[model samples]
Target: MKIGVLALQGAVAEHIRMLGLAGAEGVVIKRTEQLEELDGLIIPGGESTTIGKLMRTYGFIEAIREFSARRKPVFGTCAGMILVAKELSGQEEAHLGLMDIRVARNAFGRQRESFETDLAVKGMENTVRAVFIRAPLIESVGGNVDVLSVYQDQIVAARQEHLLAASFHPELTDDYGFHSYFLDMVRQYR
Candidate 1:
């Protein structure tokens, strides 16, 4: 099982470390061709606009859109979640728009507001300590998206077929369950 972590920016090392811990082959993806051989990909949290622009500057935006279109699993976190959101309100930026949802950027305020909380994620019984850093809260989910977890009436995590998005930084937490779940999805789909 080979997984590529979007090395454009943000949390790349953590995801690569977690993938190694999971006994899966991990690679940092920079070039467009690096995406070709992966079983799955992880789009980590960062400045959405910068990442999005870098993806295009590096000619990866359309490639990613195409990659996910084939029904392969891709898990996006935080800024990654913003990139995957179908529509973004109040933020002028470009994104992959792979997931069926709308997002509100900096929903939790700035970096100083960064905090952690235990969330009751679906399919995982234990309270997952989710790390939120300049995270975007999901405004609404489309009919096709499954609401996987919620916080304060807002959708925090969701899955739409092969695409998964989370408002928190699961990569920052010790819990690798979400990563494992995404890998399982990759295994099942592949």
Candidate 2:
């Protein structure tokens, strides 16, 4: 199946590479019109505010909401998680607000504090390597949200129906477990 990575910003190439490893065609989505051609979409990590601003400027906010309403799978990493959240701690505005979650932006501290870890994600047979860079933390989740993986007792990965979110960058690592899992999600939805 074809999976589209939101190309407004962030690690587009890395995610595309991961998607390739996961056995799916990865397409870069620069315009809202491109959303219609994908089976699933991945929103990669970047500066949350800047991504949100760009989404608004490009008229993607409502388009993405519509996309999610169709029950297609959506995966968000780091800043992308913040964008998908229904509420952002300390911030009055929400971006896409498609996932029923609340997040705290850069809760892992600055870039210098970034680190890597192996996480035993739910539904995975092996631990997955994750890279956290200025990551956000899931403060809370709605009843529909399923906790996937946690680190240091903090919510770092979760899934809500067609929506999947992670506080770390799975694409940055060599592991294809997360991408494979996302591909499964897409397959189920397709």
Candidate 3:
């Protein structure tokens, strides 16, 4: 399967590397046209405001939403989670608004509060390593959403149909469990 890492900002190469390690051909998606050849897409960590602005400026907002409307899988990490959410705490609009969840931006605090840990993701046989860096948290999820992992009693990972979201940077660690899991989602949907 060919998966894409949104290249507008943050963690693009790292995500592509992890996807490659997971046995999927990964591409850097700098334009909406690249979405045509991809079975799935990953929006990596970055500043939510900047990502949102770029997505709008580059015309990815509607394009990605249309892609997801077709049931193509999309995985969001860190600020990406904030972008994919339908609602954001104290925020006016969402970037993609494809996932049926509410997110709280930077709910995990600042740079000094960043940490790494292993997460017991639902449906996966073992734990996956996660790196949280000024990450957002899922404050609430709609009925269709499933909470996949949690940390310190806070929701960190979730899935809603073809959409997957994580509050941490899954590509920072050697564990490709999350990437592998997303490929499975793509295969299933494809």
lDDT of 1 by residue, 1-190 (tens): 9999999889999999888877788899989898889989999999988898898899888998989988878999999999888899986654887888999999988999999998988877677779999889989888999998998888899999999899999888778778887888899889
lDDT tens readout by residue for model 3, 119-158: 9999999999999999899999999899999898999999
Model 1 is weakest, by summed lDDT over 10 consecutive residues, at 90-99
How do the predictions measure up, each by TM-score?
A: 0.96, 0.99, 0.99
Rank candidates, lDDT, best first.
Answer: 2, 3, 1
All models, RMSD in angstroms: 1.2, 0.6, 0.6
Q: Candidate 2: deviation at residue 181, Å? A: 0.5
Q: After TM-score superposition, what is the CA distance of residue 164 in candidate 1 from its true location, in Å?
A: 0.5
Please provide, for model 2 over 4-61, each residue's C-alpha lDDT reduced to its tens digit, 9 standing for 90 to 100.
9999899999999999999999999999999999999999999989999999999999
